[model samples]
Target: MDILDILLSASFWAAAIRIASPLIFATLGELICERAGVLNLGIEGIMVAGAFSGWIAVWAGLPLWGGVAVAMLTGMAFGLLHATLSVPFGLSQHVVGIGLTLLATSLTFYTYRVVLPEVSSPPKIEAFQPYEIPLLADLPLIGPALFSQTPLTYAAFLLAAICAYTLYRTPVGLAVRAAGENPSAVAAQGLSVTAIRMGAVITGSGFMAVGGAFLTLSAFDSFFFDMVNGRGWICIALVVFGAWRPGKAVLGAILFAAFDALQIRLQQTAIGALVPYQLFLMLPYILSILALVVMSRRAEVPAALMVPFNKGER
Candidate 1:
């Protein structure tokens, strides 16, 4: 295809959507938890666990939707674990999160080895099909590229919108913000700070898990070692970059995803064959660090973020 043809191709946008979906999901998830004053460093582990769990569900003859469900449930479980350790026990969230990541890494490897002893090549499955909007898909340049995408991609966008609304527009949202800002004040007002934060943590984890499932079930249709590959950590940085706002986080995710998509495209071109592929692979990390440095000046983190709230205080 010519330059114009390739630029306008459905495939280019498809690649962008594919790259954006997981990041959008994960970043929005982190937004939810972080907005509620909890930092989940275990996100990497939770995502890895979700990827393995979702793949196992598919391998067990469950539908992709079923796998998604399993992944979400697994995420909720991890969220609860993080909450229990950090909130009630008053432990450092970073330490708990890191421990959880180490645990998840071990669990994923153990399960994979046990379930697929002879499988040298990673097992693959049928990925989810993209949904095309009737009239929108037929539009000019950006139509097919943007309108025709997988259900998870659409869901990622929808989740971003919904999270932004709920976090800023709803009563529960107010409570969540209060819990994150001043749990004692919220408690004096007869609201249960613990409950609100716990709910946020669990729900946030579910979102992250869905992102992981998107990677395994929709994007690749297979599980590989460290398949999440620090995308979970990237999500954390995106949350910071977005200043704990879901809409901004989604925008950040898409930006990062676009860079990633560009890297992949470069890898497949003639120029890609001439250069060292690892250099291209490093672009995402370098860009992420640069983005983080730039965005930090603008970020507005919650006042109580990363601080354990004592139930008996005040």
Candidate 2:
């Protein structure tokens, strides 16, 4: 009946985790790209491409896991295209990112239409169901919400830990940071700046694809136009708010998803009768923008971000 009732509901938290799953994937992918200083604005297109390709693969008789793989590969291919243009060829990062976004988005829509009937009813696939951990799922307030989830949800958390460890505890991570902040210095140290950057792009793009696949394969079972619904853009914004850290990004994703879940529930409740529910829907984005403005100056962006690394010159 009130804000406390909404916040304390276990079902509400459960819904939030479910909604945040795909966002966790997308935000991590964006964090990786930005950490590498690539500014891969093609993130939205990549998510769309993965969602469509993964759905098509499922419809074509591949296993659900296989569909996820297909989505990642599709995203990786786009990542390579982006890396080739911006990393090795020294194209403008902004131009390359936008071009790739347009290319990927157009190609995905066109191919889907060409292959399948572009009718009103979109095709559907079997979606992943929740797997409740025995003891953990039975816990008081947090149990059902945090413990019972699809494998993809669990994987998102695992990924957050893996990314944190990789970025902060490994030599490869240092090189990744160096490539983004000072590629010239990295090149001077005899490391191939191109290779490091390309690796980041490919890996980051794969994560983006996984995010998209989560939508089609786990969150929802059907594929349609605009299924991504600007979550990719939200992920980009969250990266800035998260300060480019994987753990912080995960926190940001979960927070945004909480608002998202709340807004959906609020719209369906009697609360909508008393107030404009659409305002609730804007909570996550509005919060993100405010967080960015308030914290952007304090955020530590890569020093050489968006600047092409010309090895022979400066």
The number of the candidate with the highest lDDT is: 2
On the 0 to 100 scale, the lDDT of residue 243 in model 1 is 75
Error of 2 at 46 (Å): 0.3
Candidate 1 accuracy as TM-score: 0.91
TM-score against truth, every candidate: 0.91, 0.96
- In model 2, the runs with Cα more than 4 Å from the true position are 118-120, 268-271
lDDT of 1 by residue, 115-137 (tens): 88898698787778888888998
Lowest lDDT 10-residue stretch of candidate 1: 1-10
Q: lDDT of candidate 2?
A: 0.87
lDDT of each: 0.83, 0.87
Candidate 1 to native Cα RMSD, angstroms: 2.3
